[model samples]
Target: MVAPPIVTLLASLVHPAAGVLVGLGIGVAGGVALLVQTGTQPPLAPARSAASPARERLPLGLVGIVAVFATIGGVFGSFNVAAIATAEASGAGAASGLLLSAYSIGSVLTGVVVGAARLPGGPRSRFLVAGAVFGVVVPVLVLAGSLPVLIALAFVAGLATSPLLITGSSLVESIAPRRRLTEALAWPPTGVALGATAGSTLSGLAVEALGPQSGFLVTAGSAALGAVLTLATVLFLRGRAASADAGSTR
Candidate 1:
């Protein structure tokens, strides 16, 4: 979250190479710390027994979750390009870091509150609402006339992000089969990576052809698509739950 501003400041004070090296060092340190916590890691599940064969196909609900996550990643990628362009147009290229920081801060604060609070409704409902809000907020970015207003809107747009992401993960955990849990969990991140690449490329083109504001349209469209996909998958998720309940009753 704070990394963008810190890296930008470092780049301005030192050099771009210095900023990259510092970021790499921090990432390495964090990886090392995670590696050192091996003792606390959960034990791997035992191999499947002959009576319980591994499923070859993934659940439809899981695919929807991945698609939604991809949309979120699209927002992030498009915002990155739009923020830099907006800041440059305003004659303050470094201000892009501040904009990105505002977005991150909003997400972090919301995530903290969500983690501490016992929110009402099931994960699917919450995810739907979050996705809708995300869709609605992103289009407003096109209306931002000043840097300050853009920053504020960016923060507002970020408020829905954490809930959407956290709920998506929870849904994945609940829906995925135990045998392929690790592989299922990985799909969401893979979707995000693919979406980010596409978003960045398309947004760059939009910004170049139209303007920075047009870049936001890509994010808005992605968000709307995510919300629709979530809505469409609700029935599939409910069916999964119903099947699970029936199995348990037996």
Candidate 2:
């Protein structure tokens, strides 16, 4: 079935007042839910002092990295055409959509591959790195601008997203206290939303002030920062594990 035009319908139905009231009501309800969930049993166990946690506090780190990636995804996903809009490229918007879709398709395929394959150092560590590298590298390749290269980069960048997301979610499930699991789970999505909103809002100013070339550079920097953050998270997790092991041996 075709979806209703919710935005248009809502505009018609809520002459601003209804819209404000409806949004406020939803916000209030969501706040109540958050309070309820926070006070209840969380999903994680009481963190063991010397025992290895199935998931460490990787989510806290991954959330930042993935949110930046998600921002890039959203920028390339929706604003590519507008960002590149010039006499030479009138169809940039359409191209952006196609490119973002290709990127997403790559991510889905990669998730299947990573999920099924048993690689050394394991999926979380290996794939998280892979995802971060892809996040950094893709923007560089896109700036270089050969169609085949862009396509490949897009796919690789897209493929990396799922692993980052999966690992981030797993970390949330494994590390968060049972009472606060829902809040933990919400972080990545919240980051994604914030990132995308910021990217979309600022990208226009970036392109106007710095040009399209520099816009990619800014995005690349964001992606690189994300990678560094991810690596830092891994290091933090490893350090925690090592300390736990040493304590146990002592």
Candidate 3:
């Protein structure tokens, strides 16, 4: 009795660390790629104001990119907490390994599609909306009491997790200044840490009170929140014309 609740809470708090670490590794890789692309020393310096307008935009652009990333990390970390709490309550805690695998699967699927298709802003918005829809769907599956359904949901959930994140990372790369790209990448990892901690702690308590199914419901709600945030980010980015311009004056 006590074990389930304790485990549920502990899982919620701890599991996000896994994702945060994964995201940080990805950010570092991206920074390396950018470094290689530009043939510049990888440093966390701000761009000089006297540089070209595009160049000057780099530092602020990085900040914008970091903003998008923090949103992604926070959303996904919330999902992880929910997944862990629900699994613990359902006596499926041992099976929770599927969550990470599922997330990876989702990320790969999204990466392939995004990289392959050169979509405009409108299409990209649709893509993010679709991800949000998946976010809503996956937790609902977990709330249902079918083992097979939950397994399938795991894969779908994983897929959703990756694409949403990749889009955010891509945005950061596109807009952040060359000088601050490395540091901008660092922001996502820190955000992931904070997100993971909050999501886990909350989900643990929620599961303790309401049960596993309700815990999943809460998870679904958080996913919806993430979806809404992604949509808002898309709209904000679109309205601003470009990330560089939006963050330039700051």
Candidate 4:
């Protein structure tokens, strides 16, 4: 979400290829920082042997989580280049960063709020929040006559998207078994990346074949699909809870 705009800004001052290089450099730097930070964390308690995978069935709830996250990531990633291209079509290509910057600002604010105040409806509900808002906002980009409107809605998009990323990651900590936690935590991001790759391809082609305005349709459609996937997640969790309760009663 944040990387695209920063790169675009660099692109305008330098060249398009430079923008891509800078974004990759920032990503590598961030990865290194993340590794350093994780390495510094205190050691965890011993893993629970009960979490051994031989006897356990993969929880459908976790599968559902991966599906939703991947769906959301694809839609969100589609906008990475599509949004800038749309802005370019509007003759705001030079200032495309403004749209993405506002989106990041919104995400930052939401991060603070989510940290301070517990958002109602829990982690799974974030899918609904993100899907609905992004679905609506992306389609409306076609109607935006100026960059300011795009920026405003882009900020709103940030607010919508941050929760899906934050809450989905948070849920992994609670739902994954102690022994499998590291591997379990990985699925969401892996799904997200794969979906994003797909989205980038889909959106890029849409823009080239159709027009900049048509590119937003990719976002709108994908986001709507994400919202629908949330129902699967909800139902899976409910069924899991019921099964657990039934087992307990025995």
Best by TM-score: 1
Over the stretch 1-250, how does candidate 2's per-residue lDDT look in tens digits? 0011222234345563554566678779998897788565545656666666555343344454455445544444223432343212433433443444556677678778866766566434764576576556656643546444555666666665666666656655665666556667776677766666665556656667765544555555556655666666667666766788999999
For model 2, where is the 10-residue window of minimal lDDT?
1-10
Q: Can you tell me which runs of candidate 1 are displaced by over 4 Å?
A: 44-52, 55-58, 242-250
Candidate 2, pairs of clashing residues: 41-178, 41-179, 42-178, 42-179, 43-178, 81-92, 81-93, 107-159
Candidate 3 overall Cα lDDT vs. reference?
A: 0.58
Between candidates 2 and 4, the lDDT winner: 4
lDDT of each: 0.82, 0.55, 0.58, 0.72
Which RMSD does model 4 reach against the true structure?
A: 3.3
Could you give me the TM-score of model 2 versus the true structure? 0.61
- Candidate 1: TM-score? 0.88
Looking at model 1, the pairs that clash are none
Better of 1 and 3 by lDDT: 1
Better lDDT candidate (2, 3): 3
C-alpha-based local distance difference test score of model 1: 0.82
1-250: candidate 3 lDDT, tens digit per residue? 1222333334556784554565578779998887779555555545557654654444333344344444445445555566665566668775555654555566678668866776667544654665576557645644556645676776666566655556666666665666666666677667656665666666667777876545455556556666666666566666666655668867
- TM-score, per-candidate, Cα-based: 0.88, 0.61, 0.62, 0.82
RMSD of each: 2.6, 7.9, 7.9, 3.3
Model 3 regions more than 4 Å off: 1-71, 112-139, 242-250
Across 1-250, the per-residue lDDT of candidate 1 in tens digits comes to 5666677778877898888999999999999998999786778867878898655677878878888889888887888888888799889998888888888888888888986788788877877777777777767788888999999988987786787877788778777777677789999988888888888888999999998778888878887887887787776788878999999999
> Candidate 4 lDDT (Cα, whole model)?
0.72
